[model samples]
Structure formats: C-alpha cells, structure tokens
Target: MSSKLRSIRAGHRSVISRLLKKFEDIRDDGDEPVNTEELTKIVNNLLKKQETLQKLNEDILENLDEGEVEAEIVDSDEYAYTLDGKITQIQKLILVNTSTLSTNAKDFRQL
Candidate 1:
C-alpha cells in the first residue's frame, strides 16, 4: 500500500482511539453531576476530528488515479448522480454474485 494510504489509515485509527478513550472516561465518571462544559468540549473536539477525517478522505478520493477508476467530478451534480448510479449497480452485482454462489453450493451438495 502507498504511504499516503497508510498515513490516512493511521490518522483514522488515532481519531477513533481518542474518541473511545473519551467515552470510557465519561462512562467511568457515571452519574455524579456530569460536567456539561467538559462533555461539550469533548464532543466538539471529536466533531472537529471527524471533519478533518472527511476532508482527508475527500482529498484521497480526488487524488486517486483517474485511469484506474473513473474520477467523479464532485464539482457537478451530474457527476454526483453518476456516482450514486454506479454504487447502486455495484450493490446489484454483489447481490447477484452472492445468489449465484449459493446456487452453486446447492449444486455441489447434490453431487
């Protein structure tokens, strides 16, 4: 895998770990006048991290090889529609393939 991909994955992991730790801390402090201000700060921090992660994911997708995967021009509504259509097509293909595998398994059992 590329260094960029590795870095992005690592960043995602770090954010998730931090979020989990924050939740654990809150849980451990159970029911004794929870500090609303501190909880708000934690939530805001996580939201910022999530926004950063979204931007990173968008950058990675935008920089992907255009030749290997047809790059969707997120700048246009038509391109967004095309992407949604492609995703639906892929979902249908997966469903069809799964059904075919099940049928094949049944045939094998009958042999």
Candidate 2:
C-alpha cells in the first residue's frame, strides 16, 4: 500500500480507538450506571467488518497487480427504460421462461 493511504488508514484507526475509549470511560464513570455491552458488540462487529473489507481490498489489489484491467464502453440509441417496464419485464421473467422446465419446478412456481 502507498504510504499516504497507510497513514490515512492509521489515522482512522487511531480516531476510532479514541472514540471507543471515550465511550467506555463514559460507561464506566457516569452519573447513572449504563449498559454498554451492546455498543461494544456493535463496535467489535464494525471493526471485524472493516478488517474483512481491508483484506478484500488487499486481495483485489494483488489480483489487479497480476494484470491490467480491460474495460470497454459502447453507446447505443435505445429507448429510455422506465421503472414500471422493468418491473413488468422482471415479473414475466420470474413467472415463466421461454425454455423447458420440469413438472416439479412448474408446480413450485404455481405455489
């Protein structure tokens, strides 16, 4: 990773740690006793998700480093799509298919 990006990520981690510390301090020493276990659980879950995303990003970077990304764009003169049209099209797609289907599958679709 680039040094600049690494520094920014470190800064974010520092800020999050500080905020979590402050939250625990408030929960530990407040006028009235408070339950912060749920909040702690949420914070931990968020941290886990962050780590997982970071790992995914690293994996993606490694894959990209292996080769260049190929992309293409094309412009076409097509009719503008509307929500209702798309909904109807999707309904038809789900309700039936153009090809063959099994009897059990057809029965399930009826149900």
Candidate 3:
C-alpha cells in the first residue's frame, strides 16, 4: 500500500513538472509566431496527463478516511482551477498573437 501511494505521488509530481516546463516554454516564446500544430499537441498532452493525475488522486483518496480525503480534495480542486485558468490565458495569448501576425501579413502584402 505504501509503495502504491509513493508511486502515485511520484506520478503526480512528474506530471506537474512537465506541465510547468511547458508553461514556461510558451511564456518564453511570447509574441513570436509559434507553430500552432506544436502548441496544440503540447496542450493536448498536458490535458491528458492532468486528467490521469486527477483520476489517480481520486483513487488514492478513496482509500483514506473522510476528513483527510476531504482536505486533500479541496486543495486538489483549487490547484486544478488555477491550472485551468493558466491554460485559458495561454490559449488566449496565442490567439491574439496569431491574429496580430495575420493582420501584419496583410499590411505587408498591401505595401
């Protein structure tokens, strides 16, 4: 049981570390025309990992006592909400940057 718990925790940490690295990469590339295909792939991968982590967390909580599980659930929900918000912000930034690039391209062509 302890080994299973440790594995779950390690998996959770790995997912979170990967997500953070992706987020940093996006931010660092800010306003530069990013490859939309690559961005989409990264986002999809991150979401899949996040969903898996959430499911694993739920499984772990099911084995714990009510009070302890409740506390963990609250924290997990808050973290998930924050991650969702960050992802939304990143998506919006990409959209805005792409639009600006498109408009600039049109202006260059007209000149």
Candidate 4:
C-alpha cells in the first residue's frame, strides 16, 4: 500500500464515519422530526459516495493483480507478500462496506 492510497482510504473512512453520524443523529432525534425529502437526499448522496469508493477499490485490486504478477516474475517476495495483504484488506473493506450500505438502504426504505 503506497502512502497516497492509504491517505485516500483514510479520507473514504472519514466520509463514511460522517454519514453514519448523520444516520445516528436522525435515529436519536426520532425519525418523525426529520424531513423525508432531506433524508432521501442524504441517503442518495451516501449511496453515490459508496459506489464511487467501491469502484475505486475495484480499480486498486485490478492494479494490484497486475503488480502481483510482476513482483512474482521479478522474484520480489516481500513486495508480492505486501500486495497480497493489501488485496485481502481491500476486499474485506469492500465486503463490509457493501453489507453496511445495503442495510442503510433497507432502513431508508422503511422510513
């Protein structure tokens, strides 16, 4: 994982945290007081952001797949191992976030 990629991921995490906070705030305040239109807009924005992040992660995984082959051919064991670890982490992040976002979508529909 390069420093730049790590930074990008950190930014994504921050955005997700803020979105979750908004959801929590709505729930705590009692959903009745929240404007339905506004809530719909917010959820739509969050879904868009999640989709963008998912695509970015997918791109990273593809790049890593290419690099992994190169690293193996070059006999760079450490670099190959690092790439493997990164691939695993990114896949896990995608899976976890996808499930979370799906849950959020369901909750929004219920409102």
Candidate 5:
C-alpha cells in the first residue's frame, strides 16, 4: 500500500512537471509566430496529462487516512481549474498571433 501511494505521488509529480515545462516552452517562444498545428498538439497533450494528473490526485486521496477529504477535493479541483486557465491562455495567444499574421500578409500583398 505504501508503495502504491509512493507511485501515485511520483506519477502526479511527473505529470505536473511535464505540463509546466510545456507551458514554459510556449511562453519562452513568445513574439514568434506560433505553429498552430504544433501548438494544437501541445495543447492536446496537456489536456490528456491534466486528466491523468486529476486521476492521480484521486488515487492519492484514496490512499489517505480520510482526515480532510473535502479539503483535498477542493484543492485538486482548484489545481485543475488553474491548469485549464493556462491552456486557454495559450490558445488565445495563438489565435491572436494567427489573426495578426493573416492581416499583415494581406496588407503586404496590397502594397
């Protein structure tokens, strides 16, 4: 049982770490025209990992001694929400950049 708990904790950490790295990569590449296709792939991957993270959180709570189930649930839910927000921010950034690029292309062609 202890080993199971440790595995779940490790998995949780791995997923979160990967998610943060992906997010940082996008931010670090800022001001460059993003490859929408690649960005979509990253977002899709993030979503899947986020789901896995939530599941791991559930597994963690299951292994707990049941002293603060409600609080843990709230914390996990909040964490998921925050990740969702980050995903949305990335999506919006891509949309804005794509739109700007489209406009610039049109203006250049007209000149």
Candidate 6:
C-alpha cells in the first residue's frame, strides 16, 4: 500500500515537471514564429498528461488510506489547476502567432 502511494506521488511529480519544462520552453521562445504543428503537438501531449494526472488524483482520493498523504495530494491538485491556466495562455499565444504569420504572408504576397 505504501509502495502504491509512493508510485502515485512519483508519477504526479514527473508529469508536473514535464509540463513546467514545456511551459518554460514556450515562454523562452518569446514572440519568434513557432511551428504551429509543433506547438499543437506539445499542447496535445500536455493535455493528455493533465487528464491522466486528474484521473490519478481522483483514484488516490477514492482509495485514500493515510491522512497525511491526502493533504499532499490535495495540494498537488490545486497546483494542477494553476498549470491548466498557464497551458491555456500558451494555447492562446499559439493561435495568435499563427494568425499573425498567416496575415504577414498574405501581405507580403500583395507587395
């Protein structure tokens, strides 16, 4: 039972870490034109991981045995909400960037 809890904690950490890294990468890229395809892929992957984490949280809560661990999981779940907001912002940036690029291309052709 302890091992199962440990594994769940580890998995949550891994997903959150990966999600943070991706967020940093997108921000670091700044206003430079990014490949819409790549951005979409990253967003999709993050969404899947987020869904998995959410499901894991539900399972952990349902099978909760230890009182201390429940507090930790709740904290993690709150952080996950923060992550979702950041991810949504990134998606918006991607859409705006793609639109700008397309507009510029059309303008250039009309030059």
Best-fitting candidate, scored by lDDT: 5
For this target, which candidate reaches the highest TM-score against the unseen true structure? Answer: 3
TM-score order, best first, reads 3, 6, 5, 4, 1, 2
Give per-residue lDDT, candidate 4, residue 102: 64
lDDT of 5 by residue, 17-86 (tens): 6766776786688676566776677778778877787777877788777786787788778878887887
* Candidate 1 Cα deviation (angstroms), residue 5: 5.4
Model 3 vs. true fold: TM: 0.68
lDDT of 6 at 40: 74
lDDT-based ranking, best first?
A: 5, 6, 3, 4, 1, 2
TM-score of each: 0.46, 0.34, 0.68, 0.49, 0.64, 0.67
Q: Relative to the unseen true structure, what is the C-alpha lDDT of residue 80 in candidate 4, on a scale of 0 to 100?
A: 39
- The collision pairs in model 5 are none
Clash count list over all predictions: 0, 0, 0, 0, 0, 0
Candidate 3 residue pairs in backbone clash: none
lDDT of 2 by residue, 49-68 (tens): 35643654454345443333
Could you tell me which residue pairs clash in candidate 4?
A: none
Model 1 C-alpha lDDT per residue in residues 4-99, reported as the tens digit of each score: 853875676576566547645754665654444555555556556555655665666666676633433343235335434533443443345345
Cα RMSD, each candidate:
16.3, 19.2, 5.0, 12.0, 5.0, 5.3
lDDT of each: 0.52, 0.43, 0.69, 0.53, 0.72, 0.71
How does candidate 6 fare on TM-score? 0.67
Q: Write the per-residue lDDT of candidate 6 for residues 1-111, one digit (tens) a residue.
A: 645855876776687677667766766885765666766776787788777767766666777677767696778678788878867977986788776456536355543
User: Taking the tens digit of each residue's C-alpha lDDT, what string does model 4 give over 1-111?
Assistant: 534554685587577557556655654574355444544555666666566665555455555656565643343345334444533444444455445456536355543
Model 2, backbone clash pairs (residues 3+ apart or across chains), number: 0
Q: Report residue 2 deviation for candidate 4 (angstroms).
A: 4.4
lDDT of 3: 0.69
Summing lDDT over every window of 10 consecutive residues in candidate 2, give the lowest-scoring window.
71-80
